[model samples]
Target: MSPFPFLSLLNWAKTQGRHSLPWRAYFHLSIKDLGYHIWLSEILLQQTQVERVIGYYDHILEHFPTIESLANASYEEFFPYYQGLGYYSRARNMLETAKIVTEEYGGIFPNNADELIKLPGVGPYTAAAIRAFVYDEPLLSFDTNLEKIFSRYYHGNRFRKLTQKEKTLLEKDFRDTGISGREMNAAFMDFGSMVSLNIKPSDDNKWKKNTKDYPLSDCLWLKTHGTLEIREKKKKTVFPTKDASIIVVLHENHRIYYSSTEGEYQSFLLPPTENDIRHAIQDFFRSKFNLELSVRPIHDKYFENDRPFVVCNAQVQKGDTLFAKYRKENGFFVENT
Candidate 1:
């Protein structure tokens, strides 16, 4: 794939009598607003309408004011900022992610893609966007909007299915445009919006408005080719996307849970009602595993109702047997062991 000529596209837009919008003002009021801009825009733009994000963007700036402030803010503080934004989880995730960035990463915007993605609610696209904007990482943020622009530019078909190969090739092509990383980010988004607004999609138009080389619903060469391949594998229903991976959590109760279903390990709130806690316990232990699991709370009392669990390095007496310790205070027995 040839370079996307992103700088040329920018020049084309400029010569056509459009000047680059001040990305800073649109995104940030000041450097203090940088983190606010990134975090706010990332959440607001996720699966949300652009028209709706505009006002909420301003509202968030009015509230948090700074990245450090956002980091220090409680979930309650951030939740109010998310009133009109449908996803309540984004606000909470951002609050948590911001704190981790502040506490662990020393308040510097993370440049590592893996580290950024590990933050709450961050994914490939969001992580790439943050790295590009903050560190000029030259990474492409491939989202549905950018995908559409590529579909119009190359597919010629009414509907284009973007294969993983195409996405990889497109990123490679756009990177060579030598445009600023931010421009590459903005151009495809603007181009996609412009294509929809200025030109109507139809077969009668003869691909004039669209620049696709492929015949509609026909095989043709594409600019980018993704290396992703499909393989047959067993599929099962799970709370979120189902993969082979599994997470197990042993609660303080005698119950066990597969962590995949729970939102997060710490997301589980304590101080639940007896019924709620019991229900959670029941749910975990209810799973298909045959081996027994139990939580043995560490205790100080010798005659405690719990069996005597060996803690630290304590040698059992000569007469001590598994049977005797099993009934001792301060321990709980597990059938698995």
Candidate 2:
């Protein structure tokens, strides 16, 4: 959303960013492989770590090769492939979603967000990711990195942050439709994850502060202390926050998977689970340490395979519509909200 074509810069650097993981090769393949790979990768990511996902990714790719093969696969047969991935639900969802794709969508993943979100595991981030990389649907994806970007951009602009009406301007920056939105959102996220600095050595550091790019780093303050302190060293720089308070936030789409880093913004395909929150407790050590944890936007698979997802907020309920997510508005990622 910068006046500049930041996406081009990040995409050019995608091969070298913090997200420059080996598993992303799955993205370069055909859409069929891309979707399947993304699905398999997300399932695995939800339950396991990145390094472990690499081999598991290859194994899943080798065995299933396509959605149909996976749809036809049984959980008894599929569970072993995810042995290292501790999250059982992720695997179950993979199988269920694959089957759903086979039975409902004719064995091909739907290129649209509505149909994609209907899949067992596909949430806002995952569905948008599928649309971006495979279908080129242009839906914007929000993740850890993006949350930082938006939070920084909207640092003091709480009018936009607190309600839906003000956030719509953000859509002009990364609307959900086409490759441009994907690139903008992806780049925004990557910028935060990679380029942004993680000054916090541990999550327990309650005081962290970071500079944002809204109006060229005009925003540099702590959620705890407010913007009264801190020096403006430069624009778009991530610093340390050992005792500062206030973290970044990202927009959560209605019906999209959501779980943010306390005051920071991050999105997930599946809603974050209690177990996931239990595990995330450890990450807090670092969050508190960050003077400003660098939340750069670089599009790479942060949530894939079997990592846990965001804890579902008040937004989701039975018979929820895709658009329903838009209405619930956590005042987080629903940029429109």
Candidate 3:
């Protein structure tokens, strides 16, 4: 509402902000190098916490080192590093984008937003980010953080989409501010994350006090709406808990039988049995893999899920041809525990 809240936000960020992030450290590098780092860091940060991604970013840089290296690496080689990162599709897209950049752009990233958006996994926000941070382009990257700050400052509905006129006004404001788009973006993000947070009902007053201390002159929301209302937290739906016996069928040659299920735990798991788990394992092996194999229970553990599952491990009979065949074809190898 200050026509430029970014001035105060940027000033605040200089003293207290997330400036030490690994991606920000690459700002001094050449555009090509900076683009690669920013692209990788942005993709990795998606749906993941900054704390979780920092080590992963460093490790990925160690492995890939460059766009060409990332492009050349096989899924088998890359996926292991990305194992605990949850969203495998993002990693896949990153690999694909790296290949596109290397093959089409000759290892140089596209500087402009339009061309950058054409690359795999690079959306509007990501493209704007790359353009602003790496190419110094004056594009507004409307991430969730910026959206909240703008909505609060301008008395706009946080949940509603911005109209064309609103968008034009925001663009014009940015143009008139004279602050670097990169710094402005960072300032808004830091302000939203640190100060004017989306907090619970009871915490609204505390946040309102903090906002008043910051003192934005034209904040229509503070003037009109008064104290920021507490955002109602969504009710978490409780799922029915279920118990299952998970089988970790290990062969004599140290190859473990793993299943490729598309769920939280992507491995061979079975329901709990009243009788012997070994007999159940044998039945599963004979039915699913078409193999006659003996099995014995190794250990049992519980896995937390929508429906909590009880996982039980079992060792399979050695000399099963199907196990070897599946392992060879699918590369479904896990350490025999």
Q: In terms of TM-score, which candidate is strongest? A: 3
Whole-structure CA lDDT of model 3? 0.68
Put down candidate 1 lDDT per residue, 287-309, tens digits, no spaces. 53322232222112121243221
**CA RMSD of each candidate after superposition:** 14.8, 16.3, 10.0
Off by over 4 Å in 3: 200-205, 208-337
If scored against the real structure, what TM-score would every candidate get? 0.55, 0.53, 0.67
Residue 242 displacement (Å), model 3? 4.0
- Tell me how far the alpha carbon of residue 24 in candidate 2 is from the true structure, in angstroms, after superposition: 3.8
The TM-score measured for candidate 2 stands at: 0.53
Q: What is the C-alpha lDDT of each candidate?
A: 0.51, 0.50, 0.68
